[model samples]
Target: MNPTAPHDTPADLSVAAMTERFRAGDLTPVEVLDAVRARVEACEPTLNALWWSDLDRQGRAQAAARASAERWQAGEALGPLDGVPVTVKENIAVEGVPMPGGHAAGDPPTATADAPITARLREGGAVLVGATVMPDWGMLSSGVSSRHGITRSPLDPSLTTGGSSSGAGAAAAAGYGPVHIGSDIGGSIRLPGTWLGLATLKPSFGRVPLDAPYLGRCAGPLARRTEDVLAAMQVIGRSDPRDFSALPAYTGDYTRPLSDGGADVRGLRIGVHTDAGCGEGTDPHVASVVRATADALSDAGAEVVEIAPFMDEGLLADVDRFWRVRSWADFSALDLEDQRRILPHVARWCMAGADVPAVELMRCYHSIQRMRATTVAATVDYDFVLSPVAPMAAFPAEQPMPYTDPSLPMQHIGFTVPYNMSEQPASSVHAGFTPDGRTVAVQVAGRRFDDAGVLALSERIEEIAAVPAPVRIVGA
Candidate 1:
């Protein structure tokens, strides 16, 4: 034990705390890695959070840590994240790792080169541990994967961590590591992050360059603390020449607000959004949490206005239909027999789109443009908006979708997906926990391309409402 340092966090592990310890010569990268691995070993039996958890995977991280230790010893450490352990979503390509992507199927092809996000993280000297699991095609929100099995919540093993970014949430929640990289399309990152009680961001579209960039997809950070997320983002959220859609070379400062109070909430017009447009009515308890958060912000000298739900059922249906038809295009190319290899729920969900009329599908596509305009228009008047991350508490891990039936699975994303469609920056941070111990979180979303603005508000929310410092993990 390092007598001078003591346990730097509740779990005795955090990216920021661990890196500081390494700087003070109170800990070695290898020692921290071992501590994390030990907890992962204890947690994975119940969590099933990692796609690769073998000796070979450990060796790769072992090599990275040894090199980082040498650098720290010589006072040549790369940066804040050097030697900090992180896991990327399996979908993010890492050379030599087969990207199965949570589908039960034939041999998956190994990536010959790292994806842009993977390369940036590696270049920044953050130790890449094994990749975390996700749903096939990242289509499902819950963590029932045909290939990787169920990813249960660390807070309650009987409940889900929620996905498409399933394993990333589980790993971070279970104290498997400090930082986990996950992608957000719809609510892949934010939804699960809320359920996992993480500080997660779905940065503005193209804020973080992605090799497989899609309409709303972007890679972002998830961690127990906001500071750790900021540290990781500084390294990965940069313009990559490879990403054609990337934002102009990322020169924006995400941490300046925290240090200098640059984006203070004082006198800011913040929207308090209670309705999600079209989900199950917000649970009274969940509504209370959002109201309390908004009340806290109001107390912090922000002008809070009640924003009614601008999203309607037709808009959500149009968005859902468009995604289904898109998924059908991919599924149709697969062998008929091989199609059954994916999660049964996802298969059913996408199959409905196979017969969608070409005219209707085209109409659905047009609806996206309309929804984007509508979403931005509704929230643009305010500096930022506050809402519940999910309409209710965490759901059972055994299910594939929440509230709605599998055939129409976009129900739970009403609050999250709009930001994606609008290309806005949205963050999910801890609000409070339910009586049953499930965590609830509040969403702070800003206008398009206002990632730093969103993050600044998120930091303030953490201060006024309080984000669990050194996050209290389950069964720790």
Candidate 2:
């Protein structure tokens, strides 16, 4: 297959389009699965995104496809993603498959049952190709793991792919799958999407169900087009009886002419904050790219307001405390040696949790909850808040970790982590590229449960400042 030639291969087709073709009898599920398998084999050496690839599992998927094809022929089909092949983040469970959670100490744990999100996708008739790679315990920003090596960016192999949803981003960008399901507690979904020039949605917390073993963080899809993300959300967003936090809400038919009503940014209020208290060390190039994006939005008729005085500096500290408590709770079952053998940074993080006093941890937990409420209240007036996703563009892959610059005061937490603390929806859309040929992104944040509003605003901006396609890495 010519990499540059356009074909109706599963790798190049979006979820919505693939479903249409399968339903129209233009292509069979088995043929699409073969195309996807071939693409994965072609890209894996350069991208290093998959945690595991099972031919036997692919065979089983093919068998399921035959059944679906029969149903289609009989004019009795199922959900929107029928016959679509996709990948999931390693942290999410898939029954009978290994959930390594980015560790090398023992064999990947066999999930007793499918995670709620996984079950939803399967029920929708999507085939699980394999699990994508992530950071150890999904705590770090860089997508490097001792067990899986480093997942490289499809655009440039030497640069870091944003993580802990690194593999999801890489897989989607490389066209291994049109949709890659990933989770984000701190820019995990948005960061990589931005770097790879893809679209991602970090839906409002509790909009998607979070079953046992993984709570607090919500999972969503990363795709090349915004409509694909919306379609995936419709299928995944539903009230699950198993998830107590799940809410009853209506899912919109996102494909119905998003542009028929001429989306305009004229007079729409957009708040821009370049500093965000990252201190003077914020990369000048990143700041310039963000400002240019805001200017483009303004040119397209949006009212761009510069935020004054910034917000509470205490937000970052609150985020840190939240991380400590959550990490401790998540890692309690692991033995010390097993933790150490997984990933060094993750083991260090787990060890830090051992020193936190119970009283102090409880205090921090309460503090974070209060901060979240206050922050959400403060942003009620603005339709969207624009900020930088990362302080810099993709950095050298050999660095200990991206976003570790000591000069930047809030280097660890930065702009993305705070939104995670607030439990509000956020997205990182590709703003533009720098003169040095690196990708830069603008983050659009919305009020709690106002995910559609944020997405609407982003679609307008993306139209005005269309980001370029990923430049294939040389000599990968």
Candidate 3:
């Protein structure tokens, strides 16, 4: 910890805190980035959370940091995220950074220009320090992979960080700067956010643009502070001509509601779904934390009601089946040698998709449509629906999924995946901790286009039951 540190150490500085320091002329962008770089350097060897960095981009980051510092000195900040340091998940394309999507095939091509989200971040003055790791093509929920290796949780090095958006979650929890951009198709953002005990928003579909061409994928913000997530979202959610799905006009300043202390849930109806609606039981400790969170919301004057499961058991299996088949189709286009480079699990999934008939795939789409309607209906009467983010907490880093019995198949993705299918706004907030120190997260989901309301409820929950500090990297 720094000798001049205030209430919190630099290692766990929040975006709001850092910006306040800058506004008071007490800190500079370079100083903040230097602290963040030190933290990343100290933790990188142990956590292996990052895939690549912008530091070696011909000194571009250096120039940008200097310019940001000068602006802070002159009281001419660019926007809400001015001088905020952030990390982008490796799957998101940044100009000059290779978006290999964690594939091990050699000689991946670098992105020619920044993805729409990255471009907005640059425009808002959030310094891009690096890119976090993910599984090959973001195929798995766990961080373990053949390409970037395993990404352990900063909370406990032995625990998996939870992926597809693995490194983004790990880095945010390890305090590699305040804000991070994560992509979620099937709970990629919220899963890691849950395991790492950070606040993450999987924005409603089309609330944020899709830079990389893919279905069911949306880029959203992840951060230790909900305020930062909101700030980052304001920038990244801006409409771009490139994205046909972009909202007609940006919903400016997501932090506005929270700033005015308007996120009160006194009259709000929040439904709690713990069984995951798939007939799967949540791990005891995980369920307890979520139940306790519900009680906390009740104490805060919100009407907490136990609700039946909103989704079917087959929802994620179908989604995965569709993705696996789609992934196989894409993999088949690769050369023989490149095909040989794919991860074993990824290949297995791809093969699983290969044999499925076109009619079955069409059935999968209809199922998803039904699932979306059911989820939307479930939340129609309630302001938000609360559930456990996952059936279990973080597991061993070496494993693929946190399944106790491999033969039984894993239903760990029960809660968050349905929200993805529904394309509604959902967030994972730190509910509490497990006996073993792993964090538990409660999912707060709202109707379509209610991204702001979802976040507002999360902020209220945050105020009522505060999240813990970032897990300090031992050596750092």
Number of the top TM-score candidate: 1
Report the C-alpha lDDT of model 2 over 1-476, residue by residue, as the tens digit.
12344543566777767778877888877777788788777778878899866446436677767777777777777777777777889888878878877656666778888878888888887777888998777776667887888888877888888888988988887777677889988678987876677788887877777665233477878877676777777778776887777767646554433222458777677788777563234578888988988999888777788874243456555556557556666666667776567666665555556677878777777766765676567566777888888777787664536645422223534567667668788877777777888877788888877777667766777778876655655222
Per-residue lDDT over 1-476 for candidate 3, one digit per residue giving the tens place of the 0 to 100 score = 22133523554667777888888888877787778777777788888888887664356666687888889888899987788888898877888887787888767789899888888889988889888999888877888777888888877888888888899988887777889888888789999988888889998887887665356678788887677788788778777888887667654556556332576667778899788766357889998988888999899788899999866667756766777678888788788898888877677667777788999999988877887887778778987899988888888888877764322323677788777777888998877888877888888998888788788888888788865654554344
Q: Assess the local accuracy of residue 202 in candidate 2 as a C-alpha lDDT between 0 and 100.
A: 83
Off by over 4 Å in 2: 1-10, 54-58, 71-77, 213-216, 254-262, 278-281, 309-313, 325-336, 403-412, 474-476
Q: How should the candidates be ordered by TM-score, best one leading? A: 1, 3, 2
RMSD of 2: 3.3
lDDT, ranked from best to worst: 1, 3, 2
TM-score between model 3 and native: 0.94
The segments of candidate 1 whose C-alpha lies over 4 angstroms from its true place after superposition are: 1-12, 54-58, 258-264, 467-475
Cα-based lDDT for every prediction: 0.82, 0.72, 0.79
| Candidate maximizing lDDT | 1
RMSD value for candidate 3: 2.6
State the lDDT of candidate 1 residue by residue for 1-476, as single tens digits: 11123433323466677877788998888887787777777778888889875324348788898899999988998887898888899999989899987887777879999999889888888788778999877888888888888888877788888889999988887776688999988989988878888889999999899888888787898887677788888898889888999999778777767323564677788998878888577888878889999998888788999999988888888888888888888778789777889777888888889899999988987888888998998988998899988888889998887754766648788898889989999999888877766788899898877787777788788878864532333445
